[model samples]
Target chain A: MTKHFVSDTLVLLGRSLRHISRSPDTIITTAIMPIAFMLLFVYVFGGAIRTGSDRYVNYLLPGILLITVASGISYTAFRLFLDMKGGIFERFQSMPVARSSVLWAHVLTSLVANLISLVLVVLVALGMGFRSGAGVAQWLAVAGIMMLFTLALTWLAVIPGLTAKSVDGASAFSYPLIFLPFVSSAFVPTESMPGPVRAFAENQPVTSIANTIRDLFAQQQVGGDIWIALAWCVGLLVVAYGAAMAVYHRRTG
Target chain B: MSTDPQMTAERVRGPVIQVRGLAKAYKELHVLRGVDVEVARGSIFALLGSNGAGKTTVVRILSTLLKPDAGTATVNGFDVATQAARVRESISLTGQFAAVDEILSGRENLVLVARLRHLRDPGGIADELLARFALTDAGTRRVSTYSGGMRRRLDIAMSLIGDPPVIFLDEPTTGLDPQARLEVWQAVRELARQGTTVLLTTQYLDEAEQLADRIAILHQGRIIANGTLPELKRLLPPAKVEYVEKQPTLEDVFLAIVGDDGTDSTAGAASPAGTKNRGTR
Candidate 1:
């Protein structure tokens, strides 16, 4: 059974990846929004914002990366919605392949596609004079945290994917997700905000994540922020995964 | 439409699909009310019904895609509810809609299914099935580019990848052209000839007459009539034979006027005009 699950997931993942390759536009479209934000912020608003740092692009890069992931995962929900509408889900359910493999394939596809979009955003940031002096270990840690965040958000997208009645409804849930980074430390530091806004910024999952990545890139003092970010990522991932699986079982069973 | 008595007798001796008191309700609306069905091995069984008469609900339950709210159903001797995986291994379902992935090429769709079924050579199996369905020419193109008939054929070809003994077709010819519908009927007949048990649901009375060894009429969530076509016809009032021969149906007139080459040139021309009008709207 485990073997079948692995094989089935790999096969279906190949199918999804083929879809990505054929329509490279989905990735391009996903990356375009975050890149536009990055360009607009780093160039237009860079000088106005005071972060006490030489380059505003460096401070904004981590936040932009998060936005990229948020926008990219909506496509996951959209694709899942299309599959459900197309009756392919029913087809897969009636087959002998492992049941959970269908969900795993979509989740993993979201991970891969989002990773590519993140890399593109980072490359664009580098072209715009955004630099990171972090060591290999620090870079690996950043990648790990980004992957965890993506997994959490992708699982969150699965809920609307499985249950939404319309295509717009399935993807519209990500609007709040894309807006979350703006309320956090992604753009301006929490210190610059009022008491209430700063408190909210400091407490949400995105701020801790953005601060951790920004600090790592700047080679700042290591703090307890890493643990908080990991806790948030892991917590959301567990809850979303559990809920998505419950919905899947209820829908298919 | 002629059914051999010896073949029917042999098929009656062993049933491949059995359902007893199968019932399902969606909240307040009862969809299937105590439906019972038995499909003999190596025979074609058609469940006939009108729209919203619970034909699809029965198919969903028997194929293990949906669970029955009450009673038991088995496929290939495996309980559909408890042994779903085992039953899935022995059966394939081609749903009302052509379930092939639109993004993938016809060849890619077949290869994907074949690989999932753990076939030795997915490429070879895909090629063989594509050729068998006469989709080899369109195999290289993405399914989104294929016509409706081609898509339906590919859907059935995908279901045959594992060579499962039992196949469930839910309204297989629902939206197809007359020529395409005939082709699908021929394919279903060929499956039963090879000792594969076929359970198909249809709303067309002629489709049941053309393909089924036994027909069950499901009306308002109940099997109101079940028997061989001859027996079922016997239950109706005897037809009055006139001295003049009966005329051909309107369908025959339409087919004759449109040409039966299976290309459906009139529809081909008419559909583009229809789309143009819709586009303007």
Candidate 2:
């Protein structure tokens, strides 16, 4: 049964990918917003923020990547919304295919699209002198971490996609998600802020995650942040998975 | 339209759908209140109702899309909630609206469904269905650009990917033009001809009169009437005499019974426009 679901998910995942491919705008449109954010932050605002680093782009790249993911996940909800509104989900529900595969397909597609968007942002970042001497093992770790983060967010996207009342409502749920990283250490050091502001900024998931990824990229030894980051990723993944499944059951029950 | 109508309608020996005490309610509104129905195998069963009558709710429940607050319903002898996977495997639902992916071609949409259903050769199934639906020329065009009728045809083609034993169509012809509606009706008949049981929900009594062997009239969350066409019409009023040579249209009966503006077929047929009901089995 598990194998059937996996294979079916893979196939549906491919279908979603094909849809994405045909309309490259899904990824392109997603990339455009974060890319603009990266450009605007690194060139316009980078020199202004003091992170004790010579290059502001370096500090900003990590945050931009998170923004890319956040932005990309909205498309996940958008695509899922389109599927739901289009009645395609209803059509799938009637079929004998693994019921969960339908949801998994969208989740996996979100991961893939978000990854592509992440890579696009990274390529653009490299052009802006964002360099890392991080080794293959560290890079793989970054990939794994980012993938987990993406999965967590993607599953979170499923709930809004399944439950939202309108097209805008589905994608609107992701705005707060994308905006969260900006307030965290993704854009700057938490220490630079005041007491209360820094307290919330330092304790949030994005800060821990961005700090861990940035450390790995800089070849610096990642300490407690890595575990904290993983906890956040895994924790969100579990919670989102549970909520998505609950909503899915209610929607398709 | 073909030979042996009764034989085609009765091929499946047992009941295809069985429901008892099915109920669904929103936070404060009871959409379906203790509704019950049974659809015989291979029969084209039409569920008729006015807005808020819970016609689509019943289809959603039977198709495993919505949960019922209180009810026991089975499809192909498998309970909807417990045997959900089995129920899913046995049926296809073409909802009131078209659900094709805008970015993908009509053919690609069908192929995607075929692939999702784990068909041996997705391309072949897609190709066959596209041809069958007369959408071969439009197959390669992105669905976003397809006409409503074309999109609906592709949606129907997509639903047949698995060729499940039973199909649910919730207001399948609501927005379709007369030609498109006829095409859909023909498709429904074709599926039934191949021995697939169908549960159709619609406000168009003529559609019900044409497609269904058995009709159930849902009114205010209850099956106010249930039986064959003759039985249902009989339930309403005296059987009108139409010259055998000229069958009396529903318009004749409507004018005779309702006087003006007709019965509005719109009343109690579906939940008012966008106020969609939530259902589960």
lDDT of 1 at A29: 91
Per-residue alpha-carbon lDDT of candidate 2 for residues B106-170, written as tens digits (9 for 90 to 100): 88888888777777788988888877777888889888898777777787777777767778888
The TM-score leader among the candidates is 1
Candidate 1 residue-wise lDDT, A86-169, digit = tens: 888888888888989988999999999999998899898889999889999889988999999999999999999999999999
Judge candidate 1 at residue A93 and give its lDDT: 88
> Model 1's DockQ?
0.74
Whole-structure CA lDDT of model 2: 0.80
Candidate 1: lDDT of B49?
92
Name the TM-score of chain A in model 1: 0.98
Candidate DockQ scores, in order: 0.74, 0.74
Q: After superposition, how far is residue A47 of candidate 1 from its true place, in Å?
A: 1.4
Task: Work out the TM-score per prediction.
Answer: 0.92, 0.86
